[model samples]
Target: MNDISMRVRPGTATALIGRNGSGKSTLLSILAGLVRLSSGVLTTGRPGLTTGYAPEAFPALKLTAEDYLRGMGRIAGLCEAAGRSRVSELLATFGLDSFRSRKLAGFSKGMLQKVNLIQSLLIRPQLLLLDEPMSGLDLPAQHTLLDLLQELKREGTALVFSVHEPQIIEAMADDLYVLQEGQMLRTIHGAENLRSAPAVYIVYTELHPVAQQAVKAVPGVRTMQPAPDLSGISCTGLTVDQKMSDTCLQQILAAGGSIVSVKPLGGLGDLTEWMDPKDQIGSGRG
Candidate 1:
């Protein structure tokens, strides 16, 4: 499972996706040099291209979170003063400033996770390796980390991580690589927004008679029909994407429509199946 090879360019966020036991963690550990690679070459830009790794398991330690982060920065060649400054900055960034001096042994799972992420990010490493940094964080904390990673990418960092959530992958990744059964099945490069091409869907619902006309008036909806019960209606429309689907549905409900269900009209096998190529408008799905 670990004999795979690939390349990632700077300034892109690539998602490493796979089910458990598919070697995602092992691959990350090998990349960080924490585990020995049995064969094949693994290379990177010259030394001083700082690299930081946050393992999936937050290793237990006796030291305070602040100390651990400062130590990592120092080892990465930051002077004592600079290391301390960097650690302080990251502690605040992850909202862990209050717990900075607390011992790791006393920290909650989420608190320790905040420390793990901060330690890796404090140095502003050129190559950032995060193994599920958002694992134990709350929703708001997840957003914070995601925003930070996007900002870091703008500064020329190469970010890569493994995640199980499709929604996060949809929101954050510029490239999605699917790993299955010890092999990389596909590599998809492009933003999720780009994938939100104009696509058609078949929507069915039971709406108030007045609401039926309102749903037909919904901008993206192309057509509608009454079912035999006359209490329900069907809508066919060009939608922006999955995200917008919810908003359009909400509009129907707000207008007094009771939605029965929504199902995409295409299969997921084709790269462009979910998106309507006509609405792509050069934003690109590469």
Candidate 2:
């Protein structure tokens, strides 16, 4: 990492990518002011600048989420009323309101990670540093983090996060620093390599076993899920490629499918899976 030079401006996101033990975490800690730099000039945000950090591991805690968040809010210099309001909004945003009274001891790893992230954003600092924040998350949780990060980016919050998932880096980063052997090997600008976002469309239609199977023949269909009540299934899971959408619609109509509705699919991979009984069949569920 000798003689490494870098710059991250506001209204942008910078991603640090590296293999494990490549000192990505160490560099991130340095950026957060937790690691002392050995030498060389290292410039960062202004003095007295507020920073939000979400570490890889949620620290072992005995407090309930409510108490922990409130305490952190206070630590962030948030007044009681502001802290309470922010906490309530975040709990609902992450679908954790019902578990507000529960202790960290009772939380799943994903829930704990969400709490960690919520606390990080509680202050709305000038800089946000996250280390492997998506490591333990399921697909849905990963999508949640993605959405939140996008929101932060849009708000012009400078982000410097380390992640192994190229998809996330591609999606959120304005600049990427590829590191190896504690050295910056290469730098890639996100806009240069960025591709068009997936043109996902939510296609709701009447259910017919034959039509359902027929629509599966569509070239760009990602998932064909049966709707509840057995009335109609949704093509909501598919990533609608705009170029192929017209062809897909024609194929669906040919398959005797009647459109109930059509809309764009947004955040999360497929949250409908939560309603699936299979979700509770995992090790913890059993």
Candidate 3:
């Protein structure tokens, strides 16, 4: 992403958001120094910066979760005893204690995801970079990870995560950068003022005739549009009044359709406001 310039301050969380192939990953890799820029200056300390990265895909390895994390801690320059202690803490904190000796190959996607997250935290990074950090986790795992992130933020660790999860951004980020074609199209700040999108849910079930008819009767709900990835029948992407979300869920269950995703697209109201040219961030829209 060329011509993109932004600053992530200490003790703040920044979210880099954009559609697929909009250069979010590349930009993130560059910032993490995994990829080098052809030109332009990246100011850093003479000794180089430290970071923690959790990519979307877990690494291919046969090591057990505990062993792998301990190895990572040592690689991060921690002493053997310290590394082991840290590994124990991280594993227990993420609820991988029972699976401590289990090899990663035998682990489920969510379990592997937990390990992936653990390795990144081996170092108390000054800046943490997480790419789609919630991709392969269930609700409980996601909550655990987010809670850890919140704890880190309180300790003054700077965070920059690339995510499609608007909820994560609204709850954790101090600023959000919208990337388009490798450049930042807009920047939205003010976490306190940013309104979380009110409870948007995406239901994914085979549409039955009875269910379809019954869903239309749900107050404040319109027909769900197919999402871009064809991942599910999205009941989200539109405004959903918070009070009616529970009733809508009940109606979907009654209709015999199973749920695929119940996403809380927070910060959506902020996005809508940003979409308006009159909004402060909208003034810089491309």
lDDT of each: 0.70, 0.72, 0.74
Instruction: Select the stronger candidate by lDDT from 2 and 3.
Output: 3
Clashes of 2: 1
Please, what are the lDDT tens digits per residue for candidate 3 over residues 37-105?
898888754365788988767865799888888888888999999999989988888888999998888
* Rank by TM-score (best first): 3, 1, 2
Q: Which residue pairs in model 1 clash with each other?
A: 189-286
What value does the lDDT take at residue 275 in candidate 1? 23
Question: What TM-score would you give candidate 1 relative to the actual structure?
Answer: 0.68
What's the lDDT of the predicted structure labeled candidate 1?
A: 0.70
Worst 10 residues of 1 by lDDT: 277-286
Model 1 per-residue lDDT tens digits across residues 1-286: 5347688778888777765555567777877888886678888867657788999898768998888888888787889999899888878887888988888998889988888888788778788888877788999889999898988899989888887665566666778666554556667777753245444454555556676666566665644654444343453333334445666777776876665556553212233322221322322111
Q: Please, what are the lDDT tens digits per residue for candidate 2 over residues 170-249?
A: 67878877665577876667554433444556455654677666666777676666544334344333456555667767
Candidate with maximal TM-score: 3
- lDDT sort, best first: 3, 2, 1
> Candidate 2, which ten residues in sequence have the lowest lDDT sum?
277-286
Name the better of 1 and 3 by lDDT.
Answer: 3
Query: Which one wins on lDDT?
Result: 3
lDDT, candidate 3, equals 0.74
Q: How do all models score by TM-score? A: 0.68, 0.66, 0.69
